[model samples]
Target: MSTWLLPESLADILPAEARRIEELRRSLLDLYRTYGFELVAPPLIEYLDSLLSGTGGDLNLRTCKLVDQLSGRTVGVRADMTPQVSRIDAHLLNRAGVTRLCYCGSVLHARPAGLLSDRELLQIGAEIFGHAGFEADIEIIELALASVRRAGVAQARLDLNHPGVPRAIVDSDAALAGASEEVYDLLSTKDVPGLRALQARYPGLRPETTEALTALASLYGGTETIARARRVLPALPALHRALDDLQALVAALPGHEFSVDLADMGSGYGYHSGVVFSIYAQGWHDALVRGGRYDGVGKAFGRARPATGFSLDLRKLSGGLPPAGKAQAIRAPWGADADLVAALRRLRDEGEIVIQMLPGQPQRLDEFTVDRELVLDDGTWKVRAI
Candidate 1:
């Protein structure tokens, strides 16, 4: 094997894609700032328990764990930043009022999320803590939509789900006490046959209960799905509330494509105590963004706060977009003359790309195209078209 060969699901991000990802990161962070979201950066690696706090087994499995040499405790490369941010909110900031935070960093997944996904992700997201109302959920959702739109992604669709909807049904059957994981797996895929087979597996499970579970598989569409869910599913208050919450959110957010999937509530992560959402768009193989209300995410940090936020892989976001054009640069001859040095500094300060050539340097460029040149024309340094 070539020494330079990377791991199966990981690879280095090249110049063009890296540029696009960085630009998008800056743009989205600025967008979050416009909404008063303060930036926060947690370590790339931290104690496993802290990183996985309030999250689910899926995140644990995705995390790459190792023994820390300093403390001899098990630490893991962070697979998600939400929990770390939650800890900061619950323990560090300790603010009584609303606290908005945004983060952007690299996370390592133990394995590829999908065939096309890389093990390394440039995860960027914004979170709102200390707010419990649907207004917070709406803000998070609106921010998520704005993220992809700002990245030039068109026709973005919002898919909303509440784990409570499925949780209510799962809890209604006492026989399903320990089978929540299996049930989540089956429903997320809308596997009706699997739900039907559950009856035989758990003999005490009711036929009507299984039917209601199966009904959820077909209860997906536009706003009408919520009304249809009310009629088809059992009249459980918890279940209805979940549906109503979705309805209220839909009402709150208008002029965007919305859909509901009671069967697929996304990665509950064991912390999403309320509405969860995923953003999908054309050109991307998987969801472009995922986030929502997880009120108790801070509980594991000893202070549960009403929290809602969303995150997206900048690499994937950039991958779906058109190629980034090479930056236009001014070519300058190698010199340490005072005037030339001053000219170079001025152009750079003005946000111009200026490349200084070394003596006998080869004619090559990777990220910049030399469209203009700086020269001492008529004894005065000036920029001229190439």
Candidate 2:
């Protein structure tokens, strides 16, 4: 293997793609600011326990751990920034009333999350803390939709779910006391046979319970899916509340595409207590954004608050986006003339990218295209388009 070869699922973003990513980052962060979300930058690494605390087993598996040489305690690179931002809200700021926060940075995963995903991801997201209403969920979801639209997706789909739907049913049944993971797996995969077999393990379980669980796997579509769910599912209070929440979102957000999948909440839905969602586009197989309401995400930091947010994989979102318009630069000959130097500085200060030709340098096509040039035409230095 070559010494310069990168590890599996890790690679560099060359100039063209890097420019697009940077432009999109600036645009999205500015959007967040307009909504009053203050930007925050958390450390790239922190103590292992705090990083993994309250995030559940999936986050632990993805985190890359190492020992701190100075203190000998274990530390881990962040695989996700949401938890760290939550800590800032609860411990650092500790402010009363609602707090809106946004962040963008690189996170390292022990392994790639998907076949097409990189181990190192550029994650950007916004969170709303201290507000528990569906209004918070709507605001975050709208921001997510607006983000992808700005990135060049013509039409987007929002898949909504509530982990509490399954949790409500599972918690009330004594037979499923220790088999929560098994049931979640079966439902998420839509494995009817496995669900039936699990139900058979407890011979005295009611037939209605088994039927309801099996039906959830196929409960998906547009607004009609929500109606079908309400009619088919059992009448538990928790389940009713979950369905009502979905209904409220649909009512509030009109003209947006939506689908409901009770069985497929999300990767971290086991730990996420309320509404969960993922955004999809035409060509992408995986979600471009994933987030939901995880009310107590800050409990480990000592101040629990209602928090909801969504994160976009910058690499994933940048895939089909149009390239940013390159600035028209004036290529100048390498010289120390006072007038030329002053003009060059003035052009740079006015937001133009001026490429200075170095002595003995050969013009390369990959470097840049000369749209204009500075020359002493008729004894006056002026910019002329070629």
Which of the numbered candidates is closest to the native, going by highest lDDT?
1
Candidate 1 ranges beyond 4 A from true positions: none
- Give each model a TM-score: 0.96, 0.92
- Indicate the TM-score of model 2: 0.92
lDDT of 2 by residue, 187-247 (tens): 8889989888876698766677788889888887777888898899888899989888888
lDDT score at residue 94, model 2, on the 0-100 scale: 99
Cα lDDT tens digits, model 1, 1-386, are 89999879888888878888889999999999999999999999999888888777778888999999999999999988889999999999999989999999999989887788889999999999999998888888888888998999999988888888888999999999899878888998899999999999999998888999999988888878889999999999999998888888888877867888878856556778888899999999888899988888788888989999999999989998888989999999999999999999999999999989899968778888899999998878899998
- RMSD of candidate 1 to the true fold? 1.4
| Residue 57, model 1: Cα distance from true site in angstroms | 1.5
